[model samples]
Target: MSPLHRLGLATARHPWRTVVAWLFALVALGGLASVGGGEFQDNWNVPDTRAQAGVEELRDHLPDAGGSSAQVVLHDDHRLEAAVVHEVVADLRSTDHVTTVTPRLSEDGDTALLYVRYDVPTTDPAIYEDISGLEHATDAAADAGYEVEYGGELPGTATSLQGRGELIGILVALVLLVIAFGAVLAAGLPIATAVGGLAAGSSGIALLAGIMDVSTSAPTIATMVGLGVGIDYALLILTRHVERLRAGDAPVDAAARATATAGRAVLGAGVTVLVSLMGLRLAGLPTYDAFGFATAIAVVCVMAAALTLVPALCALAGRRLLPRKERRAPEVSRLGAGAPRSSTTGIVETREVKEPLTARWATTVAKRPVAWALLALTILLALGAPALGMRTWPQDGGSDPKDSTTRAAYDLVADEFGPGANGPITLVADLDTVDRAEVKQVHADVAGLPGIAESGPVTYSPDGKLAVWDVEPTTSPIDERTTDLLASLRSDVLPEGVDATGYTPLLSDISDLLGQRLWLVVGFVVVLSVVLLALMFRSVVVPIKAALMNLLSIAAAYGVVTLVFQHGYGASLLGIDHAVPVSSWVPILMFAVLFGLSMDYEVFLLSAVHDDWLDTGDAQGSVVRGLSRTGRVISVAAAIMVAVFLGFASEPAVVVKMLGVGLAAAVALDATVVRMVLVPATMTLLGKWNWYWPFSSVVEVRGAPAPSLETSDDERDDLEEVAR
Candidate 1:
């Protein structure tokens, strides 16, 4: 027996031991997390950018102004009390990590802005806790009849892994499982296995955070992926095991066979996911790297559970995994009335059940492959058209929920001061490399620029080797005009050795970097996936085709995101009232994720097809039989993923919602149009060439009878003609 088969058999033989071991591991990890876990902090370390260089200079030369900062927005609807404002500023200045506090009133004098600077970067773990002092100081202003809100890093840094969305997704998944499996206990097994995996994986992330700069958003992203894949993997294995039992095999033998078959596909699918995610490292951003690392850990743990825990659970469930009516009936081989049984596990007996609806559909497509293939291609292309116009920017507090303090603060700042007041640019000059007089001249000249709404006086660093000037533009941070202004400043305006930094400039730089490297990341991920799929399936054409199909799915998803978010087509339904640029890194992240996920369905379907091809030696017949066997299961898995992702689409954060919606759309399309319609049609067109690979071992089975399908005489003739 193969290693996977042996492992499955061993676990099935001692089901309780496996269960107990998994439980102990989960509890131990949970305890470790509770005692020693470290807080997650985002590290957006883009070293090559000018904005990053400016930030580094600030940190080195001016520690007080170098650290993260926040804006305290105060409004009174009438003239504000000077004493209360000063009192609040005094408390903030004494707060821990507070280095500088500058207060400025609006032109109308009804609003005031407190610019508070800290002594640490926004990614520092201590900053989140220390910011509470600033928040507490604001309470004094609130008590004095002034409305207070926070902008910048203050409100955007908070993170949470718990929410109603996760619960709702799991509940929806359970309902779908029951409908698909027709047995509550069987449906519950996947849920149990997935939860076990999710718990262990989350604890692992907590442990990882203790050592590295894991982002606060990592856990939520990891959970979303792990939970969906975990359940789908288990469902694939359980479905095969139950099919084996109904074929009259002993439970242990059934579980072993299922693992040997479906387990291999699951392993391959998990590897593809990991490979695609790890490709994020090529983006050369630490934040993206951490994202890949955290999500990969989740996938690894869940995949392990699916491969091991699932078999044990299946053994425990036994006949209960089948429906009540089916379990009560006598065991019989679906192959035929007198099919021989083998002692060794293998595909010696092929199932000959009546024609399933999927089989009929596949046959119909096979008879008219060109028409069906063209239809699928057209739909995919049409859906993907909008991606050509996608505009990307890093998400900011401007996209926060309207009720949030951050959004209120952002709006207030934009309204009272010009919109440019919300995001200012800091110019830093390195005196060691540039003339100090020239720096002052450039600073003075910038104020007269067309986009400049206002400019602050130049302030020299304590060392006199560094000078800083803050400038505000006339447009909002996300505006195309603002992006053009930044580009102009960097390429044509700023003198040598002088660089710009600030939240807005930093976002623009990050967006530019991601845009420049987007194609490289896509190429890396696609090439790697194609190579891996080629090795796993041992067919060049299959892997290449799979890659193309996956790209189509991802593009379609991107188009949908562009339509919904950038065009404001249906943004209000998702709680976003205005059009926002697609989050800069979201597409790369989505491409990497979708490529791997789309492969899951491909692997499952192809595994079954390859098995039938080896047995019957008929390419067309194998496609029909494979689709018939695995179609319902693939649909269920896709539906579960869509439901889980849609739950996250309801998130308060725009980036999370974009990810959720994009993933859901891709999975739904891959499972239905690509896998169901296009795959069958395209494979029929390829015929025997589908398995052509000179480097791989080739098997020949001559004059072998194909599996039976229940169809009318006319339909049978058409299928036979297509097979010929």
Candidate 2:
């Protein structure tokens, strides 16, 4: 047994006091709960060299200009009567921080928009206050004896998911968890553990963000993950404990064995998961670095809960946790021919391996490596077939949320006056004491370009030192055609002194950046994961083997995502409204998550190998036996994560949905096919290769081999050895 396992078992000495203390402290943590929102910006890293700069210039010219950009559309219902408009405008402008309201015109004359302007940036408290203003505007219109409705970015995103968002989701999840577990107490325990873990996790995220402005999308992500995974891990330990009590053991012994065994899984899984997330830091994007580090920190808290509070609490509950029927269950059968009496509700005795009824899933591949490899390649190719059909790459700002008003207005304008009307190409040319006529010639050159649809009146800056024009293109903003037009504006039309920039220009720049830098990120991930694995295993070959497994898992996930989201296969069943362009960030995010998740399974399955090899010195046999034994636990864990991801995917927003579905697909594949079948078979084929590397495999076990399925005596001493 690993020293950690022995150490955890030792925690069962006084479980009840630990339980009481945990419950009391958890209750205290609840009262201190406060809601904190994120940086809440659409584009975090865009530079001011393009049309973005021009937009800022326009905002700067306006009086007391607030940096808020929102779309307020009045539907073409009879609600747009003068009284309704008057009431809306009155309420909106009368709001404490609101400065202006600009109404947009519909093609028809009846509908009018009241653009509710704010004097504060999106990150300010006033952004939320404006949502209240929206509510007031709606009420004011009704009070003035007119009907009105309001929907926009501010309400859909800002207000709807603000305070107690995680708490609300937890409450709903609690109801589900209680029903699934068949005990209120059982369900409550996981929630308590998760809340404690999240409190610590969020603070960790704040620390990371302070170091570098990590992607603002991280908090929501951390909350969802920390809660879900923390709760699930706690449930796994609790379930094992209940099973132990059902058998014939006392509370302390039952808790001891439960912590010794399941604790191994939870701690190993958590560490693996944490390491995998760190893979994103390899990608070099500051955005992903925040995501990786935040997830890792949260996962660490989860590991702490697993190893400390949970085991202690289980010990405290004693026989009360396990009913009389469950108390009769035990680990092994006396006859060695029949199952034990522990048909406990949570624990069922079952055969580890089902005889091959049709195909030996792992063995078949193990016996015929080339044939299985070819078959795997063929399946990957078939799934990737839909990549050919993924059109609609990106429009307007690539970062534009599908429901953004500017993009929505651009879409409507495109449908009517042509896509060109939506995005106007910007011409930025420097001015000096020289040649005013040269600037005019530059404007004329761009104006006469074939794809120019609508040209704005030439406007110079306040000092007459700069000139600019808004040139509508023949395509929607950021489309391939517009990109081509942008190229023309820069290369063919611009005079020697003129510069052209727009949404397309920024997209172009980012594309170049991604192309130049993405491989460096990939290399970092590979090197880091390998080095970490070698350090953990004391076998260089182990890291190489792990990298291959992680790649396969990631590729399979990409294939699944491509097939589902890109090809529109079973998308409706998946609740996806549109098979839109997957975000450019998806690949980076997937590598980070997949690598981290693969580490989780690796730690889990490899821990068994580590233990068995120590006990039996049969590497291949150890893999088979360890895989057979750990299969159910990892599968159950993976299933829960998949369900969590799928549930989140049901949201309306495409990006958020993409994240969920992508992780769901990845986990689903990882559990069944990758972990169960491919991993065992491939490792079986490459016997010694699984442990080959530049460094020698430790002939003697290291002092500590991470938290895995087994324990070491020396490692136990380091963990505060106690006589239980």
List per-prediction Cα lDDT, in the order shown: 0.86, 0.59
- Per-residue lDDT tens digits for candidate 1, residues 1-724, read 8999998998999999999999999999999988888788888778798788888888889987778889899898898888888998999998888888989999888899998888988877778624577679888888987899888775577633337568878899999989887999988998888888988999999988888888878888888888889999999999899878877778888988899889999999999999999888888788888789889989999998998999998888888988999888877654345765422223335466455688888889889999999999999999999999999999887888898877898899999998898889998888988887898789878888999999899899998989898999999898989999988988888888887898899999899899888899889988989999888876788899999999998999999999999999989999998999999979988988888899999999998887777555567878888898889899999999999999999888889999999999999999999999999999999976787766745544323332223334565455444433
In the range 306-398, model 2's lDDT, one tens digit per residue, is 666777766765654543343355433232235533111223345662543213445555677556655654554555455444333322332
Report the CA-based lDDT of candidate 2 relative to the real structure: 0.59
RMSD of 2: 7.5
List where candidate 1 sits over 4 angstroms from the true fold. Answer: 31-37, 159-162, 333-354, 696-698, 701-724
Candidate 1, position 291, lDDT: 85
